[model samples]
Target: MKKFIPYILILIALGIFAGYYMYNKPHAETQGAKADITINPADLLAAFELDETKANAMYLDKIIEVKGKVKSINEVEQGGSISLDTGNEISSVICEFEHAASIDGVKVGDEVIIKGFCSGKLMDVILVRCSL
Candidate 1:
């Protein structure tokens, strides 16, 4: 009975560890899925009052999707970035794509939807994969 008790405890511990691992592991859908919430850069600017530091920190390194008018498109040999007008009077949101494939076919004045991990006030956004 004593030997069995130790084995049972070990089994229980293993089960708990396995459960935790599964629970915390990133899902395939989540890794690729855009942020569930839709936000406009203008609205975000107004709500946060253009607090770049605060806003950047709040959204930084997080996955988000935003819709706005493309104010400008910057293309480089390697890749490029875009700035969304967000209709905000004071500021625009910058979305940067490190890879060229992400920004292909995007143009200024076009309304676009972007998704990616927020690196800062500037979003290190992944462009092509978003469904919207």
Candidate 2:
């Protein structure tokens, strides 16, 4: 027990340092980062709708560039989000920006390309850390 005391202390110190480092890790910048996959909103929705598991395997956690007409913009307490038309009537691709400035100049009916990290679908396919 005496011999192990120093090793245990060192392990505890390393654990604390690792926790602090993880807590302070910066978010990934999507604005200038290249996308892993690029697909239109309609097709992207269709893929998920047809086979959610396969879609999840392919798109989940990947940076995706989606091109479609802007359906709507929503401002919430956290930040602003944009819904892209998917022709599904009930579902759309929801792109979430960390700040409003990321979505500036975008409007409904405008054909645009947006990039984000896929977080899987609820009613709508959600993308986080989006950029124009």
Residue 5, model 1: lDDT of 96
Clashes of each: 1, 0
Highest lDDT: which candidate? 2
Ten contiguous residues minimizing lDDT sum, candidate 1: 123-132
Off by over 4 Å in 1: 1-31, 47-57, 122-132
lDDT of 2 by residue, 1-132 (tens): 899999999999999999999999999877899999999999898999999999999999999999999999987678789999998789999999989877788889999899999999999999999998
Q: Which candidate is the best by TM-score?
A: 2
At residue 20, what lDDT does model 1 achieve? 97
TM-score of model 2 (CA atoms): 0.82
Runs in model 2 deviating more than 4 A are 1-21
User: What is the alpha-carbon lDDT of model 2 when measured against the actual structure?
Assistant: 0.93
Models, CA RMSD each: 5.7, 3.1
lDDT of 1 by residue, 33-96 (tens): 7585567767665545557677666765566688889888876555577777866554676666
